[model samples]
Target: MAQGEKGGRASRVRIWVGLFAVAGGALLVGDPAQRGETALELVGRWWPWTLLALAGLNLLRSAVPVGSLIGPLALGAVGVVGLVAVHGLQAHLVRDQLAPALLVATGAALVLSSDRMGLRTSWTRLLATGDVVVPPSVRCPVTLRAVLGELRADLGEVRGQVEVNVTAIAGHVRLTVPRASTVQVNAQGALLTRLPTRPSEFTRQPHSEGEFTIHVLGVCGAVSIARV
Candidate 1:
């Protein structure tokens, strides 16, 4: 077979493999009782499986050259799984609900491993008022934070380092920047809306030679910034 054909075949196999991984992980971790519930209830009860499925689909679709929607969906799903698992683990010691926990762990792995949901050479932003939007690319250095709203990011290039700190009761935030930019953030409470902002720093200076924009949305909270 020609090189292009060989590559295409390999890509197809990879997509199938990714799909199988997701489905298998979901099945392995999911509870049959929870699966029988309504879709809304099922998601509320067993979000790990939901996240796993979406993450898998996102991974499979990424190889086929598609639009931008799946990328964000995968990111959001993984974020939910991470938040739930971390919070659950921290809140409970015995882990009475092992099934949910395992499902979440499996989904988290799928989300983290998928390239389509990972950060790329594009500007990134987050908006949150009640639901926190966690980017697969953005790794939280610290653990334990309360989220209430939404987070959003626009496509742009990022230069240098940006830092953010949010403490709000309810609201949303948006961020946009150039590609190759680095950002650090500390947040607590809920996020509600969507918008873009520049990266900020706390005690350091930016090293890049370009300017980046930062925006924060707060309902009844505070945001601090510095250069790094």
Candidate 2:
């Protein structure tokens, strides 16, 4: 059953890729005189919308978990901002005003986006290596950060609706969760992070009242969540 699901997902991904390639090919082969702009120019200005489309497509997929939509939603927001900056604003205005505003907005977004309600504890590793062991009874909404370092978190037991926010910059993070709890990983990074289609050992209602949820944000880094 898992194999069949995997195959179906792979096929769906291939279809999306093919469609994107065909669309790009059509643009490349079109007559630039009719459009008054070259294909490359159009692509440069419009590529961000593709990100928005991709995010929408992912959300439309049947297998995508609701908790996993956070990353895609953020991507879509980025796409919208990119489009506005590139297409709506003048170069001088973008550099002088929009850039600073963007930076401030990004910082604020990072702070506001994190799930901090009932935050149990926060851990940070900077230019060092560390590991965390979270007991089964631990509280929800824990935050972990790594900068130019490596970190591992072992979640022994997940009681109900446990939320973890992990961020890494030029670092690596590994999280291990118990097999008994349903696990969902919503991550954004250069590395591809796979969301669990189903719980392997213990089968329960997905997105039920209580499950393990991991939210990861990485820049030039890798984050992995494993069942054990």
Clash totals for all candidate models: 58, 0
Q: How high a TM-score does candidate 2 get?
A: 0.39
lDDT values for all models: 0.40, 0.60
Candidate 2 clashing pairs, residues 3+ apart or interchain: none
lDDT of 1 by residue, 22-74 (tens): 87567656675555454456558766666565545444433433344446656
Estimate the overall C-alpha local distance difference test score of candidate 1. 0.40
Candidate 1 Cα outliers beyond 4 Å, as residue runs: 1-100, 112-209, 215-223
Q: Pick the candidate with the highest TM-score.
A: 2
lDDT of candidate 1 at residue 199, scale 0 to 100: 28
